[model samples]
Target: MRATMAARGHGRRLAAALWLVVVAASAASARFVVEKNGVKVLSPRSLRGHHEASIDAKLATGCDPFGAASPFKSRSGRPVVLLVDRGGCYFALKTWNAQEAGAAAVLVADIVDEPLLTMDTPEEQTPDMAFLANITAPSALISKRFGDALRLAAADSSSSSSSSSEEVVIRLDWRESMPNPDSRVEYEFWTNSNDECGARCDEQQSFVSSFRGHAQLLEKSGFAAFTPHYITWFCPEEYLQTRQCEAQCINKGRYCAPDPEQEIGAGYDGKDVVLENLRQLCVHRVASARNVSWVWWDFVVDYRVRCSMKEEKYSRQCARDVVSSLGLPVEMVEECMGDPEADADNDVLRTEQIVQVGQGSRGDVTILPTLVINNVQYRGKLESTAVLKAICAGFKESTEPPVCLTQDLETDECLNNNGGCWRDDKTNITACKDTYRGRICECPVVDGVQYQGDGYMDCKAVGPGRCAVDNGGCWKGTRDGKTFSACAGSESLSGCSCPAGFKGDGLHCEDIDECGEKLACSCPSCSCKNTWGGYDCSCGSGLLYIKVEDTCVGKSTSAMGWLATALVLSCLVGSGIVGFAFYKYRLRRYMDSEVMAIMSQYMPLDSQTTENRPLREEAVQA
Candidate 1:
């Protein structure tokens, strides 16, 4: 027993010597410092102006060290901010959630939130570091307003009140170093005179560009989510004139005068301004990095310093200017962002390289699949849903909002057709997407009157001498007296079209029976035959069956039948008129008389259309 005691004594002495070495090493690595109120905190060099938030506490250890209790305030309607030792997994839900709940700071008390001391790092053999996520801290502010009411009453009278009440200041760091998809390394913040990301709430309350610099780091790092300081001034908004009293505003490590309006408890806060400033910083930073293709490019672009949008002087300039300065390419510019289609042929585009991403062709239905081009989405292995959403939202910049057939924007819900949403226009149940424009969400105009130097022809000009579409919009000349078909190529039919080879004006375009010319046969033994649109070239003049190019034959031996057919074709504009007009009538059967009346009422200025027989200006769309 005495030998065992000696062995234990030796081990204790050796462990004490090792403890001294660790303490000395830590003293060398870490220095003690104090930060009073209103110190300017700067973000890391790589991440500009990233500041760590702070929170006050009751006793450094709120919960019993050996027992258990919660840090959550049951009376608080605001979301819970778990004040454990180290800020970690339990409450770090996401930045979005934090911002939504209006959490100004985080406080991690002592290990009472746990029964034992939880170190910042985990032991190697431990399979799961479940304790790492909960917040842990040595000590914290004891008298701050938040902590004053939270102090738990303890019956242990031997514990000195001063000891429990004493405040402990700690450097601002993510109390717990946790790895998350949105951010890998937690930011540790400190303040110095030259910290560059914040701005004074002076005249314009202009924001310094550096704050955004840090946010861009988070974005580029591919963090799924994040939240920065939604800072609030701890001091009162009204200034204290006494020189002895500390200044309430924290500006660059010094307290300065803030506007009476900007004093704490001011109804109109700069929270939105803070949000916008971050967004602007993102824009400037991302733009600096060559070309930006991402769309989660979050920023504040809404109007400011304006009471109404209708006033000409009221500028949506804040939003418009920030967005415009990023210098987006024409194809990258959002369509509806106040700028309308300046050029008819102009198109919005997004490209990783040479592939044509979105080509809004005329009659191409709608761009409603307001996302990656329909086929492209399914084609490429998009990294995540984020990539898909970004491509789609970016592609949707300036796309038309859907207007239901009911003509109501609010009530119109997109209807699902076979695959895409159906357009509201009753006549054309074609697929419509957010990207569609014009009356029917028809594809952008790509052709037609555009070819004409003048803007476009009106409906009145849809007749004979007018610039009307002819022959299915393929050829455009008035017909005289010739039948046209696929047999007759899409060429103008005029002049006494002669039979093809002979080329005189008898039956315009008929193949002349040149085989009847005995000498033209070139060989008395050869035979040649003729057909419309072309004829067979051969040796014998009898009947050649070869499908040749130019074998024009003279009048056939069966001439009596041909003469009668020519008489009808000569009956002005050819006997083909009735058939062609009927086919066209199939397309224009009848107009909705009721709709015409409604349109007429709306267009009372259209003097040409009177009440009796409303002369509708039949505009022919090409």
Candidate 2:
């Protein structure tokens, strides 16, 4: 089922849906106040907060709809308006032009129904243009509705009979903040607006078309925004293929980091090739294997960590060396490296699997270094001890493995804060626990009595006689010359005791019958007898014990017969009443239909008959 789900891309689809569900919850909105006639009007703005730009002067439109410099500039220092149309000009260019023309800030009005967008520039730009693209002056995008209302308000004020220089003002105040990453992931306007291609289009006309399609798909899938994050690279023609592949990834709106330059020579190491081949192998093995525990432990947990910690560069040669060092597989590397199609397929498959695993983990892949045991992912800290605990908890066996049961197995938790050692039997507490501050052992309590306080957070009862409060059998000592019980010390706050009806050693007690010495049964009409640690009541000669009511009542077979008869009579009467009501309803409907037919035959169906008739009423009662 998981394989089928992965193949169908169910994991990515689910992750997208989940991200969208929490988009609003994870993101904050831009603070902008727009008022008309002292009443605030609702408007959507960019999530990126900028400096406040208040405009009380007449609203001035930029010379170009895209905010590019025109023959006429906006009134100096006045807020300039721009239209969200055309794709050729970047948002930065439009805003820069307005800024250069002395506009305090630029407001790009939406031409479509989409909410205002948080604009970003193209990935690659000239050095000088990049500086200008920062949008230093407060800038924002406003909805088409808000722009229209502002225009109408301006027009209304412009035509007012009373001449007042003061114009209708629209103030936009931006608080310092940024949109949430999840909210940015949910932006799907690109998919709807870019109609040239779909998410799964087979072919495209050009690179731009392909790039837009891929970006739209990524945004719709809640992966990233619809803008590429490019990394400039300097490479030779030999590695042009690599550049092309990386460009494809970048154009899809994914962050692309340039790989280290490859030096092609007669003595080329083929390190990159080997690393790629090994990655493909790992993905294939993980995908095909029925059990992933060994694969993760051997390759991911052990080999990956060792290689990373040793600063061993990940290459094809490094992978082969690691495999040889592990003393298992060198033949499989060649097999994996031989199939290029398999490499690509496995790459895509690995992505799907990772997303599936991530969603199964916690709906967030950012919490990395994850551990999955028995199909359940651990959401705790990325520590070996934490992982071990999760894996142990997944076991369903009656007996734990020897390693799991032994405290001799070293762990960082045990080394920290004198956590102390475990007993050979795993049930007994050691003397090291006497002065230990942390948890040492998980001692079991007697039946009917549970250990008080947290079991593992802090083993306050680990010291000598501390278990006395819960009556645990841990320690004992003598008071003066007399031998006292384990928890008889006045300083010992922890001890155990039997419940009301039980008695024995604190750690091992049994229930006792109190009714044997006391007249506990109060049922007057029943015979009482002691049973186990409790009592049972039985009805006397002519009575029946009703367990539901917990009482004895007079037995009456005749009364039962009467009740059965009454139930039958009631059911019969109810059925008869329903049948009569239904029959009456049907008869009334049939009679009404007949009456309507008779009336139609005697009288005209319309008032026109009265107007057409000459002194009607049966020709004056002839």
Candidate 3:
């Protein structure tokens, strides 16, 4: 049976992270403010403080005197927006206030007269309280109701010098230092404009929607900007030489001596700065705006440090400063989770306020009306809200990949996906992961983690396993659980067979040319030698024939019976003829001797003893 197994990880460093997520969040939004260039708000009248505002709440029709913990407590089953009496509350302060009000979150809004428009900075500055929402989007609706109630109370307390819980009225017209926060609502824009001014103005408007900061908002919405922070390495000029770079690795770089070259309109100009455009690219691309994450150095931090300076001493310092700057905030990291973590601070305005305008009971009365509309935080950088909005929109921010992927072990379309790993098409297993990929979703965590070349990146096993995308065509990886050997059809990473004569480099397949290698040889003269898949030798039939097919040719007489018979016939005929001729000669000699003996009349049988006296005449036959 196929089962769906989900693996979850909380704390992962993003590539040049632009944002983070908060836990236990109620909900969130992709709120943005795109209307203001630099709006400055003005109200004809002044409004009372929070103390007076709550008193006025009592007068509202729905006001519950001594409300049960929170007015919206019973509304938990539904999405509830915390409605604050005013905007300009920071996350820490607003978070606390929202809890106090029994609100999931708070939306602080201006009285329509004072809405800010632009920002040049982000973190913090002088105290011109910006209302960064610590609540949720429902707070916006609540703000409307809260504002309406305040107006009603204003009428009741307007004429009287007495301090009734009634609200004070501020009849006002408005001008924004930037753009109007309300314009975002009117325009139906999903995000702020791309420029700094637009981002700041939109941030101000967006802040009024919630004071939870980026983290909580993302958590609540179950949405995140998939933007990755881009961090680039600008090496020193000397690293260009491949050999030198291989040796020291500190000198390679595209940047000029003083400053690295930048892809943007402005080149590095002899100064090393974090690449802003690169960061934006990452935030917009890799990490995205939907599932926000942080940025880590991956495996390049050490290498990057070395590349930063010509001298080790200077490079070390530069690397240290850069990394420190790049590191995520402790509290932010803790939000996800980590070791030796401490409780997060709940202070309001932990960061300095970036903008300033007026001063009053709210601490910036002249700017109060705009504060309510622009949603400045009570504490923190004035444009932090805007920065957040920019982060979410993925226009001003982006995400960069820790590494690039190569095509090999997977099918052609596997890489088309943003994720480098492949999925099992048959099982519909997206997490199945490629065997040789750098990043795997299901790779072991902690105790079982396996990586390539140490622990820099996680690795996994995938199939129908083929070849590795690395130098070796062989995919039978064994190191780090990689094996470069396998059955015939099931070759390793390269998915390559030895090709009848080829070999492998452990990561991939290569050709093994026997002929080119001088492995082939002549017969008999050549002794045989074996190689990867073929054998070459000197075994030929020309030297001395060993009749393997016809075993009984010259060695067997029966097989040559015809010739042997002819030889016997010739010997018999010659012997018979010679005997006949000898017989004839003897007969003729006997006849001649008889004639001679007859004439001489002295031939006898006993002549043999007296050959000299008988004169052989008796043998002549008279």
TM-score, one value per model: 0.19, 0.24, 0.21
Backbone collision count in every prediction? Answer: 41, 11, 134
Model with the higher TM-score, candidate 1 or 2? 2
The order by descending TM-score is: 2, 3, 1
Superior candidate under lDDT, 1 versus 2: 2
Q: Supply candidate 3's per-residue lDDT for 62.
A: 13
Report the Cα lDDT for residue 184, model 1. 30
Candidate 3: Cα lDDT at 450:
26
Worst 10 residues of 3 by lDDT: 12-21
How far is each candidate from the true structure, as Cα RMSD in Å?
30.0, 30.3, 30.4
TM-score-superior candidate, 1 or 3: 3
Best by TM-score: 2
Model 3, position 284, has a per-residue lDDT of: 28
